[model samples]
Target: MLSLLLAAAPPALAHHPGADLDKMMGSEEKFFQIIDEPAAPPFELADADGKAVRLSDFSDKIVVLYFIFASCTDLCPIHSEVIADIQRKVNATPMKDRVQFLAVTTDPVRDTSEVLDAYGPAHGLDAGNWMFLTTRPGQPDGTTQKLSEAYNVRFEPLEDGQQMHGAVTHVIDRGGRFAAKFHGLRFDPLNMVLYINGLTNNVRKPAKPEPGWWDRLKVMFL
Candidate 1:
């Protein structure tokens, strides 16, 4: 199934990496939201260990980024599981080093370093190419949540300790271009992988075929 979807992808056209991929995904993958923006919204947050990590730090790698909190009992867990599945598929391929997965916690107040450390392994996320990020020390508790809004996603706090939000998987191309979004956990994981493969290939439009001798002769005569 994965191979078929990849095989069906349009041949790289002359242009940026996401151009052809966006066209193909628009036609075939309903869940994909093509952003194609020049620059993605920049962000600066802390990793589990309190090291400052900025979006610019990953300028050379394709980033698969998403938002989630540790305590949500609803879609967050399912979303992480879906990310885990995608990560597994991505790790099995040569694209592993070319891609990075990031999960940012919306509820940083309760998601301590301990919780962040355990969340990835607990959800089958590979720490080798993935990182769970939280708000930096002294930053407002709602910092990360506010950042989510820059990506057009909202994580609303509720009285029950659960936040209301939608599931969105953001894919940023190398060099910080906002590529696209895979909305919802129901998207076919293979499709996401294939899209990443397209980006990694750095596919460019094939050169136009030169005219044959007969065509040249015809052109000369006409």
Candidate 2:
């Protein structure tokens, strides 16, 4: 059996390193309101630029995730913009390479790579660690349904071209463990950084892709 490994190198397009955050003391207190939940379901989706991304891809650090439907005229954009601000705060602090941001779209039909690519610079989202991803429709189990099911997020389309669902942000550790859930749009970036720092400095193992058949064969004693 042929075995392969995805060795670590400096990440491209969305990786930033080196930070010093002495400014976030006592900021972790507000996180008391957010509850830690079970890990989100395992799934793989494609980024706007057409590269496959899995939960494992972010096994290197804390991952910040939020769901938004790109075509919505208002709130979705504002939510993503807040995420972009979080990205900026983390990047400018002592937690640069220790975290990443994932902005996933619930609406794929109108959220193609071109569309996502266009949305970034508008909200200062073009930085490294900011990823825009989507699952093309008809991709195995219906894209929206599958992803929503994975996160336990609900989205029912309305007649006037809007969706009815809760809006929240998720923080996941390298092992894909759900760390916290921020229930609303307003939250502190300092709290997030402190949490990410906790995970990065204390993680037991760096995330690795699940061993496939070949990987198992390579380790077999037979």
Candidate 3:
């Protein structure tokens, strides 16, 4: 049975990994907005500990980025939950170290150190690979909100202390390339895991299988 399966398997094609991912996802994934930009919008924000963190800091790793505020009662929590699910799936694999998760708060003034610190663990985000970022001390309150606009997302302030915004998960490849966006909270987490796997897999060229190994195995089984 093993020999039959091996003989029946289709020949592996040598193609660019990024192009393969785009082709596969273009047909199967309706939620992805693929971007061809050379660089993602840059920002420098502070984590819960008040240490400055910039987008460039993660230039060596793939970045899974999103925007949210702790006080948002509608889509923000749902978005965080979705991201947490994706993070869990990513962390389970060897690709964990090659990826980083970042959540930028549009309401930096309200999401203080304490709020940013608790938001992750509360939503099941692993602190080892995830971070919730906000404006550093002395930065304007609307700084992050404007940055969100640059990423093609909007966070409108409402009279009720909640933000009006759409949920978009941005994928930034190493070296700051804006790769794609997974829109809304409904995209399958596994699809994202697979996408990140493609990016990481592209870093190393895979060895080709030995020629005629399938035929040799089939003859042995016969």
Candidate 4:
């Protein structure tokens, strides 16, 4: 069976924490400024089967990175449902062979192998083209805080033991660099396919890390 591997991009890239704070504070667009020069941070986490995977492993394919905990009640579920829809839509496109989806769970304590093994198929995730990952405290790539900070995700474990995070999807080119970013509850994977296809023949580099959803979410809540 064919399978996609998750990878850690590289260090030095470690997103400059809070650097986007100024930009986000200013613009109403609220998307990461699209640095377009930095590569995705390197990472190594385990797949549902307990096998190690890295962002670099998908060097020649498109990777969609998003943060979510399995027990999410609202946006996460909506985001995931959109992802599944995107997957179905992409299967009919020419970009099918070139895409891979990576869902990283911020709540590792609860999103372990057993959790993923259980969550994988029920939610329309195809282990061959899509991989679900959760990093333990000492997984050797980067810390949860580092990854969360890099991606700008602020996840707090609620009393009910559910995860709260900003809803955003990270679209990384095959070269392991940031490309387009899509936000909001609704998703359009075709936009991702078009960008990847256009970028395939050009020089790719790491762009800036996307911002956290907490600030935006707070805005919505208020």
For each candidate, C-alpha RMSD in Å? Answer: 8.9, 13.6, 7.6, 11.7
**Which scores higher on lDDT, 1 or 3?**
1
Evaluate all candidate structures by whole-model CA lDDT and list the values in order.
0.81, 0.62, 0.80, 0.62
lDDT of 2 by residue, 1-222 (tens): 111111221131011111211112223344324334556566688887788888788776788888787787767788887777767656654456778888787778767788888777877884577888888545863576557656767877788877777667777877777766665666665455545644565533334323242223222211
Candidate 1, residues 86-113, lDDT tens digits: the string is 8887776666788999999998889999
Return the top candidate by lDDT: 1
Model 2, runs deviating above 4 Å: 1-38, 136-141, 203-222
Worst 10 residues of 1 by lDDT: 213-222
> Which pairs of residues collide in model 1?
13-205, 14-205
Candidate 3 worst ten-residue window by lDDT? 9-18
Per-residue lDDT of candidate 4, residues 1-222 (tens digit): 111110121231244223442243225344433545458777888787777888899989878788887888787777777787777655544456778888887777767788888776788766668888877446654355468668766777678877666787777776787765666654435444334433433423334644654232222212
> Per TM-score, what order, best first?
1, 3, 2, 4
Q: TM-score winner between 2 and 4, please give it.
A: 2
Off by over 4 Å in 4: 1-33, 136-142, 187-189, 200-222
In model 3, what are the clashing residue pairs, if there are any? Answer: none
Per-model TM-score, in order, reads 0.84, 0.71, 0.84, 0.69
